[model samples]
Target chain A: MHNIKIVLIQTFHPGNIGAAARAMKNMGLSNLVLVNPVDFPSDEATSRAGQATDVLENATVVSSLEEAVQDCQLVIGTSARDRTITLPALTSQQCGEKLVAEQQSGKVAVIFGRERMGLHNSDLKQCHFQLNIDANPEYPVLNISQAIQIVCYEVFKAGQKQYEPQIEAYPLNDDLNRFYDHLESSLTGSGFIKPSHPGQAIEHLRALFKRARPTSKELQILRGMLSSFDKE
Target chain B: MHNIKIVLIQTFHPGNIGAAARAMKNMGLSNLVLVNPVDFPSDEATSRAGQATDVLENATVVSSLEEAVQDCQLVIGTSARDRTITLPALTSQQCGEKLVAEQQSGKVAVIFGRERMGLHNSDLKQCHFQLNIDANPEYPVLNISQAIQIVCYEVFKAGQKQYEPQIEAYPLNDDLNRFYDHLESSLTGSGFIKPSHPGQAIEHLRALFKRARPTSKELQILRGMLSSFDKE
Candidate 1:
């Protein structure tokens, strides 16, 4: 069994929770923890889960975030896009990759916020990093369950791709995703991203780096480069 | 003005067709050709296209694949990661980058097979090369519009990135997938796939590479290794 747990904090929809369970099942992940879900074991959720009822039945439901992730060695919070907080962040893939690496050492948990508002700054502070998916700015919001599905899928994929006998080169996609988010965030914070228009400049930046698909190590160097920007 | 004209062949879902149009629009490509789409001027498609209806309204609806690419200098077919035929293939990004490059010299057309069966072998034969997206083998299929979005998005990203003239050495995700696929195929052909299990061997292979996250040059070497098996 994998040493990773997926936690949804204050989830608003029963169907989404169910769908999240289904997504987890499809990815071979069983440890699901829900924090104050709107409904549980509902007919809508069970039916939407299709064959994933087992996941829902076995899921641990808690009332608060602290209780859900207390034992986790690594905790990651999932957000829609940009948040007001200056917290360290990782893309969904990064979060997944990190979880896998951490799994080798200890248990890891990924935290997802509510549908409408997402994770609160207070909630994010509890996490090792915030998770963001690279989505179109015009429509930055993703359905809570869909976001969960993508993140869970990436994590599951990253975990499977972990073959130890052969030392494959480069960071996994999850690690690369993390580095990209850090680069983007650091760049934006450093004012390298000019406001030429509403979203065009950022779009151009994304276009540039996404093509590069920087490795985690490369990303670490980019972060170091950005950190040195403060000295200049 | 990129040389790629994305042709949706007999797309059944109007919303998907519309989404495909939106995807192409976001990627900065305008040339779209539809072949016998189930519904056009559809409220769902138009509504889904959001601001991209102009692409749909201006899209050329052709009678056949031949008519769609007759005047093109290069034709590429898109398929998910599955080997139902024996054909030389490129990963989606490779096809996208090559097509973009080819467009600098001549016209290129990318044909998307029907949603259900994908490009028929005969349809695939019409193309200069077949392109496959690296997705989870169990659910390797992607929605037609999602497929279009990813491919066109990569193409647009590549075009913008190429202009920067940077020495960034990052390998693309697609390149990694091709090498992985080649290894999987060879393993299966060699009877390394576990008996009475449909996906055990391939799943293990996917897990192995997913962790490694091979670089472009490294992937090339791995593919070269697989080619040696073919020669034997």
Candidate 2:
């Protein structure tokens, strides 16, 4: 099984946190990261966790989404609502397969947003891809824990390793973010993206790089090229 | 899409029923049938259903599994436990594909058992095959509604219909049950199976017939043969 982490952001109900823990543990996933949860160590969460309270006890609480998935090589955001800016979208099954294949290299994080609003545009921008659980067109808003269950179930299915293939290790989210920062500064310094009117160019660049998923060595080479541009 | 029915047999939790309804609606499956559910029209179930109250409102409540699936051509039972009397087992994906392909003929019922105990052996006997949702071997017991969600999701995925063959209509569960009764009594009358020592003969016969899945016309022909033996 892959070392998969379940990240819940700004969760309102502690019960959902507990239920999500149970869902993760039900699929052999242990790591649970919470970003700005409303309540922790609540009776409701503990009670809802049933026999899987250990998952809650050991869960990491972080202040931001970056901290939650900083060390992860692959970050996937679950979105219930359609966004104007399209990220590379994959069904839950595809996400699972990709996550499993990628897990051979490093850690992977599947992030879920708030109970009511789901993942914000800013949060989704940090993800390599968005996962949409193919739900009813009429009532697409699935419960957070239920969504967790679906994703975890898919991962567990893929964990059987029937489609296992060794793939190249992608850089961690932290490395990717750093590269994005370098790329942005280099673009501004090179007068490619005017500081005064960058427009949506940076956003488009981020999406393009996310899709490309440059490896660590590739990122280093790109950074060296940016350094050459900076010196010029 | 297949005309799929989600059946909950002897369900103890009204909230689960409501959640199951929401799960079904989330997957574009509306038909809900309850076989002796402990509570219906309860606040918990309605609250859990969220925006899918129409599913609950239109759900069919029945006294027995026979009544619940009598009109259905394909009856599949979901089981977590492996039984000594082995029935053809299919993962949720295979079951989904088969159900979707079989949907061209008639109604299909995917029955879920009680919350704590799951389906009784007698209940499993009624199904043509068993559907198992792959989960953690350490904790394979998924919540009732969660199981419903997984199965419904697979069916929804299979609903895309890559394999749409128009198969001949098979007899309903009611007709099949009636034929089994007729065959049993006729066997006793013909001295083939004595009422005193029937043993597992009827069960073996049931498994045989379930696999054979005789069509309505074939059932009528078999019934006629039994009637002739009765006259002799």
Candidate 3:
């Protein structure tokens, strides 16, 4: 995966910062730079981060946007509103492709503004591309952490699949079955399947996608897919 | 754009229908077939669709998948899982090419399974191919409407302005036919396909390949598919 930096400018909520850290970690993106975030070292941020405290602790706290994105080749500003400025705009996929392309040669940073008002006009002016997620117009604004999660998730998916060691790569059928057992147990607790027909339902799901037998990359997608549902 | 039919199978959410319609419309795709939508003409759907009500009203609502995709020459079931079955798999891009190619000469359909459990194994068994959209490891799954948007968006992007008009006269259909014949013969020669069924099967293959009639450059790469499979 490319080393992508995320700069959150003037974040007000500590819980959101922690949640953003968790989102970044989930998507395999760890480089986070906070510009004047309120309550950075608070318990709220740490607790919300869950298992991603390392990201917050290692986060580089800066006082200015220029400092945060100084060394970055690609700068992207996330905004839901159309600022009507003539910035070189790109969709998330375009941004993803562009970032992947640049990763071959240099580093990239995606800069996000504050939660409520988003980036000021001056903040967006310094970016190379603007990413506007096509969200519901009525409720176009997304929670800061939710937005981070979505972006990081896409970045992770764009990376090439990982290869396992040769011995582990060719696992026995029993191992496969054991993995499914673990998956079922985890899913059942999450209410993915009914208790009375756990085997039947899981077997059906297993049969639905048995061809690829799922690499770890695919397993992650399944886990993420199920976890995203946990939000509602 | 290939005249491909989109099947929303057993969709329970009307808002998703609206969003799916908007997605299709934005991509310049018109054909939509809904199988057993839980609610139609709902305020939520119309409100959510915003400007895509025409797509929703014109959508064919059928009671069964057999009716929805009956006239199509190729069928694709979208899944986030790698079902245990040994089905031929295609990425969204490959599927987009195939659908567009088929659209030139015949009909095609892309089927999205039910929201909760997705397509039953039996439902997917009917498809010639399964296309998976890579997503986050934990939440690799996408909302029904979001999936529709992404797939259609890719198809639209693939068909965008990539051609430059030449001063040469329009090539005769026979010239195109000769190229198609050469492609078929080369694909067959490379042993990319099993030669058990000769007549209609080959015709199906021909129609399928023709649907996304390749450019001169793409035609050259199609031969690579044959050689790569040979190595595999």
The DockQ leader among the candidates is 2
Q: What is the lDDT of residue B141 in candidate 1?
A: 56
Model 2, A1-232: lDDT tens digits are: 5368899999998978888888888888888999999999799999777678999999999999988888888899999887765577799999989888877778888999998899999999779889989887789988888899899989998888666566555778888888889878866665556778876656755664665666675676556545544554
True contacts kept of each: 0.00, 0.37, 0.05
Give the number of the best model, judged by TM-score: 2
Model 1: per-residue Cα lDDT at residue A147: 63
Candidate 2 contains a number of clashing pairs equal to 0
Candidate 3: regions farther than 4 A off: A1-73, A78-85, A88-94, A101-123, A130-157, A161-232, B161-232
Query: lDDT by residue for model 2 over B1-232, one digit each (tens)?
Result: 4378889998897988988988889888899999998988799999989889999999988999988888888889999899887689999999888888888888988999998899999898779999888877777778888889889889889886454385557788998899889877866665556677876656655654564456565566557545644654
lDDT of 2 at A171: 79
TM-score of 2: 0.81
TM-score per model over all chains: 0.54, 0.81, 0.52
What interface RMSD does every candidate have?
Answer: 19.5, 30.1, 20.9
Error of model 1, residue A211, in angstroms? 26
Model 2 chain B worst lDDT window (10 residues): B223-232
